[model samples]
Target chain A: MRIAVQAESFDLGAEANAFAAGVAGAGAVVTFTGVVRDLPEGGLQAMEIEHYPGMTQKAITAIAEEATQRWGLCDLLVIHRYGRLAPGEAIMMVATAAAHRAAAFEAAEFLMDYLKSRAPFWKKEITTAGGDWVAAKDADEAALDRW
Target chain B: MMQVLYFAWVRERIGVPREAVETEAATVADLVADLIAREDRYAAAFADLSALRVALDQELAEFDAPLAGVREVAFFPPMTGG
Candidate 1:
């Protein structure tokens, strides 16, 4: 498993290829990328991401470990960005490899679900009006129940 | 001395990111009470516990959790990570 919490942007294609190539016996690989979207009014200037340094890594590692143990993943890669990012920028990506497509897809979804609520990162949206912290959604928390 | 940290609006409201807090508080709730009594900013920040979350020694924890050996405590709003 490889986990990176960085401020710099990453190439999605390169990352996906690297993850797939490293897992020799894996038959399936799934990659999911999250991108920033403009607000309804379309005035979003930037999204500032704040995270707890030590805790952020620890939380994500734990979540990835659980995914590996439950799904018998051959490999997994998680890369999350921090700091300010404009709309349309990629925020993060998760790639999972397994012997079958089912495990790869399911583990990828599980990682995304846990990362949404459990990771120690907060986002503040800056727009023409002002900056506002993005509130946590009940649906995001509820999504965990499926796992 | 415990390392008390705040994030997001909690840090903004309290006007500090982290501080060294010397306290005799037994539980996380007691530590919060002490901070609330220190200044209005702290009181305002901690006014609604339901809107807040706490971590003890970098792990998610409840407000009533004991702080006997905890060296670090953090307060922040619900995480919106993805």
Candidate 2:
């Protein structure tokens, strides 16, 4: 299991390949990447992300650990970025490997759902109109109830 | 003295990232009450506790959680991560 919390951007395809190669005997690998998106009205210059320095890594690691235990995952990787990101730029990614596709897919979705609300990061969208902090969605919170 | 940190709009409202606070408060809510009494910015930021979340020593906690041995406390809106 690997968890990285950094401001630097990453290469999604390369990282996915590396994660797959490293998990030798695993039969399935699933990867999900999150990207910065523009607003419906369209003038998003960037999305500035802020995170609690000490807590971010700890929280993500704990979440990944839980995923591993619950899914019996062979390997997992999570990379999250903190700082300004332009629209279309990759923000973060999660990869999961398991003996079968079901565990790999389920674990990846679980990781994303938990990270959506449980992580310490916050996003502020910078549009031409001005900046606004993204509000926590009720749907995201309710997603946890499924688990 | 305990280190109190703020994030996102809470930091913007309080006008600082973190500070060392001397308090006699027993719980997170008590500390918040003292801060609100001390300054208008704090009051505005903490006006609605329901919209906010607290972390005691980097772990998500409740407003009524004790602050006895906690070295750090953080206040922020609900996380919108992922």
Most DockQ-accurate candidate: 2
**i-RMSD of model 2 (Å, 1 decimal):** 0.4
DockQ of 2: 0.94
Report the C-alpha lDDT of model 1 over A1-147, residue by residue, as the tens digit.
999999999999999988888997899999999999999979899999999999999999999999999999999999999999999999999999999999999999999999999999999999888899999999998999999
DockQ of candidate 1, scored on C-alphas against the true complex (2 decimals): 0.91
Candidate 2 lDDT: 0.96
lDDT of each: 0.96, 0.96
Residue A30 Cα positional deviation in candidate 1, in Å, after optimal superposition: 0.5
Local accuracy of candidate 2 as per-residue lDDT tens digits, A1-147? 999998999999899989999997799999999999888878899999999999999999999999999999999999999999999999999999999999999999999999999999999999878889999999999999998
lDDT of 1 at A92: 99
Candidate 2: stretches off by over 4 Å: none
| Clash-forming residue pairs, model 1 | none
lDDT of 2 at A20: 90
